[model samples]
Target: MCPCGFLLPIHKGETLPSSLTVRRCDLQRFLKVIRGAGLLSRKGIPAWVSLDASSGVLRLRAANTQVEVQLQLEAADSAFEAIVDAEFLKICSGKEASSVTLSLADDEVTASWFDADVPRAARFVLRSSDSVPPAVAAPEILATNEPHLLEALREAQATTDPGASRFALACVQLRSAEGRIAATDSRQLLVQRGYQFPWAGDRLMQITPVFGAQEIDRSQDVQIGEAGNWIAVQAGPWRIAHAVEVEGRFPNVDLVIPSPSSLVSSMSVETGDARFVLERLDKLPCSDTLHEPVTVELNGSVAIRSRQEESAAAVELVLSRTQRNGNECRLQMDRRYLGRALKLGLREVGFTAGGGPCVARDAQRDYVWMGLGQENTISAADVGDRLLSEESVGG
Candidate 1:
């Protein structure tokens, strides 16, 4: 928090702590930086952190260790707070960068990004006609039906690899057939599977975001094609429509997840360690997609028959080591997509991973594993190439 009456100077080129300002440039920078990580960016992030530019109140929030510092913006004329992802700030550093820059020109937005380290920056321009942008509200790490998905995502990978790691995870592709969500980092390769939601009609196929759990959790109105990619999360005072789908092919990343298991068993979230687990995954999200209460089975264990509608979480990413009997299961998915899925749930949930991605349908049958291939070790581009090779073989 800035000093009570401290008169801090925000440099000309530098931006006011975004959480405190509603400057258009500041907002754009916030989104651009957050959107940089090529394939790892969470799709359904909150539009904006609450703030009234008219009221000079500054509320700045950037969290690490599950605890964040909010510099409440306070100005008599126009006060506001800016909520930005701590990770987004890192993208602006230009060191480990695979990001796109979003610039505004009289309400027009253009994106220029470098897909890989060696290549020059490439730009993808979206015309007002080509893009469908909802009004920009307050941006956030993960909002909407919170408390649960955040718990799950954190349980999956609390601390993202400030460095880098590898693994495959479940994924949602709006048009996986066309290629949308993908694990693009060389260190984190992603495999994906297309899922059909109960309301899936003209709505795109997607790997729900970290906030999705919450949206699905609290939503009473689950209309299908009537709603597009926008899911109106009704939790906070204001209802919000978050973007959950990506328009591309989520790589076939199933090669990394262990083969389909007939031995399906139910699991529950940890009890006391819930908060701790969430904090950890929030920081990482780079480790494999292993949620605390995810379904599992022993090497030769019997198939325990079951399904659970509600089972609170104990911890987020207890890791395979935390298992009671050294019995843990590997969740194969598009890491990017899985991280996004568990972004906004309320409490922990019951899950079962058979062989593919079936969105944790209790501990019972063979569900579709979202993706194939290894994550944390390979980039989505490489996986795409390998997929191209496989396609050639079949062709």
Candidate 2:
């Protein structure tokens, strides 16, 4: 068996033999790559695993409809290719063994493992099946800063509506010329800048599979490649390719962001105080996670309370150091939306209070959400009156 030093990529249409053998540790590493690339869709999407000895080392490729990942390892015997349930490799790799052999024959693929130390041998078999076409080759290479890429991916996810019927709303728009990534769920918009992809020019790519972004290694610089409507991300030994949404244009996020002159008053709040209030709200019942109304006042004092009548356990939490420019104002929104922004590791939150859209901005990222309308807003005086009444009743 030849020693495998580094894993190299394998393209489609490679010559393969009938059987191959790999150490248990190498098999486990392959499984980890599969898990990180998010090729195994919860919708039971099957994956294709193929091996090729054309590269001198054993090149293993795994792919589903939306993603494809490739890696190489040392192996004994000839190469083989097979299409099976996406979970097959995971189960095979989990078995207790020192080494595993994979063979293809009789319209089926078999995984055999033996632990000589334990004096036991076991095998699992699954019938081979057909799979979709291979992923497009990503040849154009573009270097990206790790921190910028990760920040854009995470901020865009907060605004993407994965279940949206429209492809644009369900994806993160990568506008290279603008040097920013944007996503909107219609109710809110999040824009993250500082990305430069000069190779893409004015082109826009809508990335649908955002989960792969989480698997990127932070220690290494991220490499991006593009071919047709597909984008590839490669870091170290892991390479993840995803299909970009091509049907629609992402809404212009810049049009909606509040301008400085339009913002009347703004105040900063400690993230710890915000978290404490959110924890109290989480105890109450919420019929709609995305639209459950929660009102916040940044006038003379800071206070938050759930607006749903069904949540009888709701309580108003007044915060410290919430005082602002003496202007009295209140903003009502879904607590879930606020929670998403706060979870971005922001130390403080700044709110733009005026007769304009609800806008929140931190150092690098900006958050915007629509209010629940006048019918849902409770005046500051009314809140004070209600709190005093509750205290009297308790006494």
* The candidate that achieves the highest lDDT relative to the unseen native structure: 2
User: In terms of TM-score, how similar is model 1 to the real structure?
Assistant: 0.26
Q: Model 1, 6-80: lDDT tens per residue?
A: 122222333222222223334333333223212223355322222234454433232221111122323445433
Point out the worst 10-residue segment of candidate 1 by lDDT.
382-391
Whole-model Cα lDDT of every candidate shown, in order: 0.29, 0.59
State every prediction's TM-score relative to the real structure. 0.26, 0.75
Model 2 regions more than 4 Å off: 1-19, 23-38, 41-45, 53-59, 72-83, 95-98, 104-108, 114-131, 163-167, 202-216, 284-290, 307-314, 323-326, 347-356, 379-395
Off by over 4 Å in 1: 1-52, 55-76, 79-146, 151-229, 232-395
